[model samples]
Target: MTNPTVAELIARSNRLGADPANTNYAGGNTSAKGTETDPVTGEPVELLWVKGSGGDLGTLKPEGLAALRLDRLRALVDVYPGVEREDEMVAAFDYCLHGKGGAAPSIDTAMHGLVDAAHVDHLHPDSGIAIATAADGEELTGKIFGDKVVWVPWRRPGFQLGLDIAAIKRAHPAAIGCILGGHGITAWGDTSDEAEQNSLWIITTAQAYIDEHGTAAPFGAVRPGFEVLPEAERHAKAAALAATIRGLASTDKPMVGHYTDSAAVLEFLASEKAPALAELGTSCPDHFLRTKVKPMLLDLPADASVEASIARLIQLHEQYRADYAAYYQRHADDASPAMRGADPLIVLVPGVGMFSYGANKQTARVAGEFYVNAINVMRGAEALSSYRPIPESEKFRIEYWALEEAKLQRIPKAKTHQGRIAFVTGAASGIGKATAARLAAEGACVVIADLDLEKAQAAAAELGNTDVAIGVAANVADADGVQAAIDATLLAFGGIDLVVNNAGLSLSKPLLETTEKDWDLQHDVMAKGSFLVSRAAAKPLIEQGMGGDIIYISSKNSVFAGPNNIAYSATKADQAHQVRLLAVELGAHGVRVNGINPDGVVRGSGIFAGGWGAQRAATYGIKEEDLGQFYANRTILGREVVPSNVADAVYVLTGPELSRTTGLHVPVDSGVAAAFLR
Candidate 1:
């Protein structure tokens, strides 16, 4: 039988975690105590169920809870080795499982199990953290909550801190929760509902107090030269600087990126106090872990030219890296894990916005979100009292902790396309859509660009939405449209690693019957479009200093000299030659240019469905429905080619298997001997 307590705990966690104000993502834990029948002995046993390590409360499930025997957990108190060897306690948790533990116990498990309350919640709410991080947090707690909440001074979260909180609870019988100095808040209740209400009250009350008492300028006055830029200009500047910033951030490894000009971010960056606050770094461990100890702030004024800003950024990054290495050296001991990397994860620019980087897009975006939480915390802290966080030494201890290193080691190996961003033109349907799906499945962040914005967004949504994919409208034939699409890609994912030039249409008329308009339109969309996309993407690819892939979806008609396909065949030929031309020109920069020559991709094909199938069937003297089989039967392998076939060819060419091969055309036409490269 399921324990009702665990179910209620899940509900409470979801309610708290669903709102950003309640806590930053995955930054808290919740627990419930209940009795369950042991399957082995048929004995009633008390168990503690708490949110497991690395689980996000908002999306938490039954499996996300770690179930431990309450008696066994409390027994460890007698053998507690003190704070210095606290990490070893984490290993001992495996022995305390109620049955097969539901999930791995987190460091916070001690706090939940040792407390007397039936339900408990530990949260990193921005408002609560604001009060918790204030310089006079103890004094502020008394002023705000009176006897309802008590103050617990700074202590790294471990077995000792858990014991301290338990002692605090016993001492203050009337206290429902306590604010941990330089951290967040912890609340408790005899019932699940009471626990949730207590947590919410603490959060809302802190916010209310700050609202009433906080000064008008929490972050100090907006600096004269750092005012937020106009919206259009702000975004344009962000797009322009994205590539250079991304390149600098990827100093350690290739990273996917995210850009935000949110009001909070813009306001903070434009304020006079931002530099000092950012330097103090974040108070909460969760904040600095994702955002790094602190962000690298650009010193240039908001109105500085892009070139000048980029130039200064180059110099600043070198200093930031050096300073980070020195800090690591200052704190690292013989036992500490190696320095992870010197690169900054979050970068702040006054007047523009913030850019964050990680191995993937979600990680990057979340880092940026965490920084915003920090920003809010700082705002409230400054308003209520002078902002004060834990010392730099404490932050260094948490950043390089051995237990944290173990967690990092447990993350699954990266997929083949991980950290790579792919841009697919005309990706809303047909071969382009199939290609986008394949790339995304293999862990590439995809941009589905098409003439139809609605279909493009729908396609992107199917591939996991903004986390791993985004949709953009691009009329590839127009230079402006193509450039805009490229800029959007940069803003969304930092830099491009792959470009698939697949946007095209066909007109199956003979040279004599093909109108001049038909010739120009086909050439404009295929030949000219491919060139424009390639040209626009090349600059960023080169600027990023990372090798890239450019694959063209040319047709078999490019080489087969097929009848009644003059306009389409010529455009494809133009694309095929571009592969060779660009391969030579870009080889020096490690950018590979390749082409996929597919024959008669009829089923589920946008071009075929849009009248090309009927026109081709008429020209071939065959029924439109039998055109696929007709083309298949003519091939040596007698296999009908589909969009996925072309997609497979694309994956193969860009994949590691063909890393050294470029300027080559691979056929997906089931043995088209005539179309085979000679």
Candidate 2:
């Protein structure tokens, strides 16, 4: 039987975690105390169910909660060593577990258990943290809450900080909660509703106080020529610069990127004090862990040309790397985890927006969101008083904490296509959609580019929303449409790492029956379409300096002399040579160009469904339904080929298995003897 209290706890946590104003993603925890029958003793025992380590309150569930014996948890204080050894207490939490398996306890478990309340919430709301990180936080707390809330000075979170809060609550019976200086807030109550209300009260009161007493322009006036650019120009500039920034960020390790042009980000970038405040960096641990201590600021005027701005960025990046290394060296001790990396996760550019990087898309997006929270905190802090953060040494201690290293090590190994971005043309259905799905499953971000916007978006949604895939409308035969698609890809995921030229139309016609229009239509959508898409995608691919893959979806018909397939076969033959041409030209840049020759992909193929299958069947004296079997019987392997077979070939060619093998054609026609490469 499940405990009602834990269920209510999860419900309360979800409510608190759902709003960005309440807290950033995965930035807070909630808990409830309940009674459960112990399996060994067969008796009712008090248990504390708290949001465990590395979980977001908004998505908390039963398994996400760590249940421990309240008696044992509270008893930890009796044997507590000093704050110097408080980390040992975290390890001790494992021993106090009441059941066989539960979520591993977080550093915050002590704060929830030690407090003598039935319910509690620890959140990093931007409004509350604004007061918390202000230089005069203690004074502000008194002025705003008037004794209803107290203030606790900066202390690294552990068993010690837990005891400090519990002591304050005992001493101030009238207080609902306390503001954690240079951190956030904590509230407690006899019931879940009361706890949530108290938390909301603190957040609302702090925000109202700031609004009443704050400066109209906390970041100072926007500098001349630094205002946000027009929407079209801003995105175009961002698209052009994303690859360069991503390349710099990936100096230490490859990173998936996310771009944000939110109002807050633009306003901050245009402010007079933006550079100085960004230099001081974020205060809250959660903020810095994601945004780094500070961002890599692109110090250039808003109107600077893209080439000049990129040159300046390159220079600034070299210095940023050096400064980061020095920061690590200044505080690192023998026990410290080897400097994780010198690369900055967040980059700020005037007139444009922000670029954030991480091992994956969600991580990168969340990092940007956290910086937005930090921006809000900075706005309020500077308005109330001067923005002040904890000492640099303290930040260093937290950044290099042994506990954080342990958590990182527990992350599972990355998938083969992890951190890769693949652009698949004509991905609304059939081979293109299947290829996109396969790449996404292996951890690549995919762009579903096709002439049909609605179907492309639907396919993208099916692959997994914007984080894993996006849809863009592109007529691959049109240069402008192709360029727009490439630009959209860069803005969505930083740069292109893989290109799949699979958009084609098929038409079966005999020597006399084939018209001039038939020849041009097939060539325009296939031969010229592949060329336009590849040429446009190649600019960013080369700009990123990350060497990428370009795979042309040609056909076995390119080699086999089949009757009444003149136009389609000729275009395929054109595409087949493009593979060899580009492979040689791009080899020096590490861009591998390859081709896939697949025959008889009748089932689920848009090209076949659109009259080509019927035409071919008529020529071969078989029904459209029997065309697949008829082609299969003609193949040496006697097997029917489907969209998935072509998709699998695409995966292998782009994967590490073929990392060194390029300028080659892999057949996916179940062994076509006549179509075999010479």
Candidate 3:
């Protein structure tokens, strides 16, 4: 029989994880005790299904729950003192796994399992944690929750912590939950709803108390508003700033940087006491492992040029790296752990909002989300009293703890473009969307720049709505629009590593029949637009000093003849020559320029959407019934080319396969004779 308790636990865990105020990323866990029939004996067994390690509560599923034999887990509590004393309890939980496939349960599983309640929720809501870790946390927890909540001081999480929790439970049998001073909170109930209610009750009560009487961040300076610029200018300035962060934090490969300058974020950054507030460390302890204790702080000058500011930022980052190394050495214990990566995940840029860096957008987004939450909790803590988090030594313990460190270290390797960024023009549809999707799949952040902002955003969401794909309103023919698009890409993902010049409009008409308007439009988009976008992107690629790619989306018509296609052919011809010329020039700057000539990619493509394809198929003498297959059979390979086929060809040119082969023209038309590079 399906245990309703487990399903309820999963539902409640997701609810808590969904709210950043409740949990950030995969920080909390939920568990339920229920009788599940054993497959072998067909008898009910006492099992504990707890939230598995690294499983975020908001997205928790039944499969994500780890099942353990509660009887076996409890039995090992007494054997720990006689055994090695270290890891015996943790090992017992691992050994009691009902079957394989489920992730190892969190270190708190034993602690949760020891709870007698039918349901439990362990959360680290920011506001609640702000009160729990407050200087008068223990006293305040009692003052607010009274006998409803028990107070437990900070204790290292492990077998010993489990025992401590069990003892607390014996004394506070009537208490709904316990607030761990300088840590988190735990709630229990007869049902999952009750357990979640207890957790929410504690959080709401603490937050209410803090709101009613909290203190501001302690700084002996007046609050000052930062210099606010218009939206376009602010994001442009933010892009320039993000580029520097990427350069500073990256050791071997550059980290992708993301900027946030929302009103709330900017207000937090502009606070005169912001620097001191950032130094106090994260509002929650778990973030110590994610963002470190404090962020890398920078005071960006208003009058400084982007170049000079970047130079200064790099210099400051050098000193910051050394200081971090010294901090590690100062805290080194007999274990003598090797220094962790020195890259600062969070960077506080005064006058602008904070910038976050990660190998990819997902990681950066998580860090950014937590930092914003920390801002809220810190402000609340400031209002109630001076915000106090775990000490640096304790953070060191959490950061370097064997269990936590082990959890982070054992993971999959990076993809080829793990930290790289890509920008695709006309990415709202057709081959461009396919290209952006491919790049995102390979771990490169993608920017979808198209003429239609709404469609671009929709396409980006289709690719992945996780902020990895950014959408911009771009008119490739307009210089300012193209510049804004580039700026949007930079603001969203630090810098551009690949620029696919695929934004073009086609008009198939004979030289004599082509109207002047049609001729100019085709030329402006296919030829002039490519030049403008490539030129705009060249500056940043050169500034980053990182080798990049500039691939033009040419057509088979550039080399082959097509009836009544003079405008399309001429524009494409210009593209082919432009690629060869750009390859020669950009090659010196370590940017490899290439082109993909695709033929007859009709389905779901801009060219076929009531434009050139329909006209060409109508003009052809072949029967209308077989127009779609006309070009497919005309090709030597007799295969219909799709957007993905062109995308794959473009990837080959930009990826490692053709690193030494620039000025290359790849034919993605399943073997074209006349379109072959001569």
Candidate 4:
């Protein structure tokens, strides 16, 4: 129906919004004009239901559609043309809202309301944006879409631009859509489905034309002979760079990584033409909005030390912000609002993969994904003679547009631990995993450091919030490995707010049966690993100057004597002492050191996995099924100690309740008389 209802419109919007290939992350909006009964007045009213600003259409619902009187919105067109104050124009849009506190209608609301169609879809598809941004974009669009699409020149998106679009529609009554040069495209139809398909057809048709005659990435393919470092080495280098850039950029809102270390990324970074082409603007205006006009590029020495790389990165970041300020001043006029934050969302290192940063991991990841897709779009445009992005002036206008700025300004402040970054060792499973998951739930971005990189990633994915959790590989006992893990934490999340030393293993043998290898393994993980990780994390904690937490997951064996567990008991005792010493040493810097001594946690425990469960059962002359019950009954509270229970105790040590308590131990063993803290 040409007069589509709001439900029909929302369904159509979600269909278009669901495909990121069709629209960037929440970058596009949609609208439909229909009739509805005014709830209060009981009269038929014509309304425009447009996608709410900041709400992604793919996930949009009816509530996300800001309803406004269609006639009232169209009437503003005549008045807005002469209005000098953009604030007054914004008030007009706000006044027309039929749903209070609903998403402010998109900046394109006026344009949508003016179009003579039952349904409208506006998006920045990858190929479509490339064509829109080309130097000969308007002429090329005419050739590809023929009579179906018209060309609309760029004007800051507002009442005036909407008027311009409406004029094109009036002149070309048969046109299905129009390309907004240097911005994006808009399509409309009598039916919602037709509108969306029209948008896609234009993109597909434009791409086919490029395939026949357009230039391919003119910079040439990534240089074949360049010295690309090993994958592990490149990851480490990228981690260092991400950490340094995040350190420089983060303040109250610490940046978290949506890090990608793929082969394609490495190729781009290693390209001989990177230093030149990378400096150019983004492939599409929406891409620019997410990644910023251009990434902050850092060129590290081929053999630079981690410390050297970080130092240079900080210096370069300072220059980048300064340049951003100058660029704003060059294009900003009296009407321009205060400059947006100068921190670069994308960081490009010459020989390493790109890193995307945001207030949280989700935003960072989405931005990172867009940048990756933009990479291909840019290459395509480059191949077609040369990729010509919009000028700096147009880029500035869109970036600082009131509507876009409002989206960011509306971001709710982080939770108590929202900006805090935590590194949890041995986070692949059991208590480590539980603790990591809990910390993320409470708002801390968590770095899962474990020997098994693959398992660690799986655990992070299970956490299901990509922006708040990341997995890194490291053997905590190795000094270099510990440092690398710490760097990964910094890379994934800009700073270290807490460190959880929960990685340890045991052979479960008596002193007489303990081999040198078994003893070494026990002491290396329980004692040495804790010592090294704490020492490595200390530098960044001290530098952050905001105070931090270091938690050691010790065991009841650290204090209570146990048969057939000498190596674990002895090494863990040393680990407990280390915590006390660190608490005393680091307390002055706002750092807190504590330990969680847990016992009888049989279910879902990494320590209980393998043949150890059967062995422990046999030690007590009981079947494996009875072992759990026996241990649960042995505790004074007669309760089972689960991984989540231990995780809760760890939180107590790190949370606000015990801020004044350090060098302390919380027993999460359901109450062991012999293992009492006293």
RMSD in Å for model 3: 2.8
The Cα local distance difference test for each model comes to 0.93, 0.93, 0.79, 0.78
The candidate, 3 or 4, that scores higher on TM-score is: 3
Candidate 1 overall lDDT versus native: 0.93
Write model 4 residue lDDT over 1-678, tens digit each, in one string: 323477788788778777766777787789888887788999989888888777888888777778888878877866774524554576688778774656777677878888888888888877777777677777877778889999887666677777787788889988999888766788998887788789888877867777777645444665553446777787777665554456666643466665676665566676666667667858566687878888876676445676786777778778888888999999888877888678788886655667787767777777887787676666556555456777788788778876666677788866756667889999998899999989888888888989999999999998875576888998988999888788777666656888999997777776788899999988998799999999999887876666789999998988898778888889989989999999999999889999989886788877778666776787788898777788889999998888999888877778877888889887888888999877
Per-residue lDDT tens digits of candidate 2, residues 1-678?
Answer: 568898888888999899989988989889999898888889999999999899998888899989999999998989999898889999999988887777889999999999999999999999999999998899999999988899999998889889999999999999999999888999999999999999999999999999999999999999999999999999999999999999999988999999999999999999999999999999888889888888999999889999999999999999999998899999998988999898889999999999999999999999999999999999999999989988888889889999888889988999999999999998998899999999999999999998999999999999887999999999999999999999998889988899999999988999799999999999999999999999998888888899999999999998999989999999999999999999999998899999999987998888899999999999999989999999999888899999999999999999998899889999999898899899
Tens digits of per-residue lDDT, candidate 3, 1-678, equal 446877777788888899877878988788999888888899989999998888888998888889998988888776777323554566667888886677687788877888777888888887777776667777777788889899888876676776777788778878998887767888889887888888898888888887677654333343443455566666666777665577666765577777777666667766676777787878466666667667887665444466776777788778778877877877878874567677788887656667887778777767887787777766666666667787777777777766766776777888876787888999888899999998888878889889999999998888777567878899999999988888878778777889999998887677788998998999998899999999999888877777799999999989998789888899999999999999998888799999999997777787678566767777786654466588789889898888888888877787776789888888888777988778
- What is the alpha-carbon lDDT of model 4 when measured against the actual structure? 0.78
TM-score of 1: 0.99
- Could you list the CA RMSD of all candidates, in the order they appear? 1.0, 0.9, 2.8, 4.5
**If scored against the real structure, what TM-score would every candidate get?**
0.99, 0.99, 0.92, 0.83
Which residue pairs does candidate 3 place in steric collision?
A: 214-383, 214-384, 215-382, 215-383, 215-384, 215-385, 216-382, 216-383
Q: RMSD, model 2, all Cα superposed?
A: 0.9
Clashes of each: 0, 0, 8, 9
